[model samples]
Target: MIVPSSNLTMETELPRMLRAREEAEPGDRFVFHSARARMQHVTPEQLLAMNQQATRAAAELADGRPDVVATACLVAIMAQGPGYHCTAEDDITGALRAEGCSAPVVSSAGALLSGIAALSARKVAILTPYMKPLTKAVADYIEDAGIEVVDAVSLEVPDNLAVARLDPADLREHHRKLDLARADALVLSACVQMPSLPAIQPVEDEVGIPVLSAATATAFRILTELGLPPRVPGVGRLLSGVEEPAA
Candidate 1:
């Protein structure tokens, strides 16, 4: 996975979500390798500039012989408007190909969309650690991908490192603030930098809806694209072998 230099949650949560069941053999376990695209803030300008390093990050991840690579930034891709993951994925592919690597690539933005679709989610509620403008952009991006944003709550956090410092338990109040009456799914962490994995299942149990985060969705996309059984327990409903039409 490739992420912003200051984003810390993906590296921790993604690996936990990707781990196979304990009964599985060693060969069934998946290892993750990551590279950072220089970024220290979650603002639009910095995010747009961050894409300039994705190709280089892809090339660096390619050096590890990874079977799949993912650009693990949600708002960064969504900030480019709808359907940018295709172009972004193509850019990474070209960069990796140039380095004699042909591994498939996925983006956190696309993965989140795919994951919501897999859960058959239509109307959704989302929580983000981004400022209001970027949160609106993320909601617009998700809506453009065919999901309705019924409600959205932004923590209004500006500093990238501070987002990483937020405790998962603190998200419970934010989750309750969303008007989920008409919502079919809840995006607990629309930004990968914010910690939400520990809150996902509990929020789902309380709200009685499928809960997911960018990190869990990205791991699901990676396993699905790799043709592995997309089953990882204690994460959420999307990873429980849910199926949808291919992207």
Candidate 2:
């Protein structure tokens, strides 16, 4: 995974989710390696700067000969504006190919889009860890891609490290605050750095709709790119291994 330098949750959440996958499929063993791009605050300047370092980060991960590479930072990609995920993924893939590693690349930004489509959700309510402006930017990016954001709640977090320190359990309460009556799905945590795995199931069960996070979507896309079923326990329907018809 290529993650922001200050991100603390991706390494923890991703491995835990994959470990849960290991429980269901004993034959699939896993090891995680990460490459970091410098970032400390969740501001636009830092996000763009951090993204500029992707090629170098991808080079570092290419040495690992990873079967699939995933960029775990969601905001950094979206901050570049709509449709940036396609460019970002292609750039990372090119970097990997230059290193003689022909691995499929995934970005959390693109994965979230694909995950939403897979669930056939036309409208969504999202919970994000960014400040209001950034949150609006994320909502805009998604909306420009054709999904209507029925409602969006920003926790207004700015410090990158602080976003990681937020308790996942707190997301359950945040879920209650969203106006989900018109939402076909919920993006429980729009920012990958903000942990949300533990809350995914509870939120889904309560709302009776598809629920997913940037991390879970990236994980599902990773397995999908690997030609494996995206069956990971405890995450929501996207990774339930049972495929849903696309929108």
Candidate 3:
């Protein structure tokens, strides 16, 4: 995981969401390594600056020769506009190649897009911790990928650390407040930094639709890219066996 320096949620939540089942083999567990990029705000300038560290971070992690690398900041890539995750993934792959290593790379932005597609969700609702402008960027970014953002609510938070400090229970209430009648899926955390891993399944049960967070989507994409079964229970509908979208 390559995350923003001020974003404290991914490392904690991802491991919990992806833990090996109790009956698995001794070595069946997945190991995670992370690299941090400097970021304290959700603005365009800060996002661009934070993204500059991706290549170097990829190179550093490639030294371990892991199965996959994930750039786990969603808004950073989305704020770059549509299709930027491809560019970001390419950059990471290039860096790994330069280090004489190869591993599939996934970005939170790309994973979210792919997860939504795998669910075949068209009209979707989103919950974001960004301010209005940044939230709009995320909604537009998703729209460019052929999905419709039927409704979106922003928390209008500026401090990245504060966004991390948000409670998952509060997220459940916010999700309940969304107009979910027509929404095919609910993006519990459009931004990776915001904490929503624990809220995913409960909210889905409450709303009777798929609910997913960027962290879980990235985990599902990583497992898919590695040719592993995506049977992660308790995350959401996406991981319980939603076939990977057609490439």
Q: Supply candidate 2's per-residue lDDT for 138.
A: 94
The model with the greatest lDDT is: 2
Model 3, 187-235: lDDT tens digits are 9999888888778888889888999888888888888988877667777
Global CA lDDT computed for model 3: 0.87
Global fold similarity of model 1 (TM-score): 0.96
- The clash tally of candidate 2 reads 0
Instruction: Candidate 1: give the clashing pairs.
Output: none
Put down candidate 1 lDDT per residue, 64-130, tens digits, no spaces: 8889989988888999988998899999999999998879999999999999999989989999998
Q: TM-score per candidate, in order?
A: 0.96, 0.97, 0.96
What ordering of candidates by lDDT runs from best to worst?
A: 2, 1, 3
| Models, CA RMSD each | 1.4, 1.2, 1.4
TM-score of 2: 0.97
lDDT of each: 0.88, 0.92, 0.87
Which candidate should be chosen as best, given TM-score against the real structure? 2
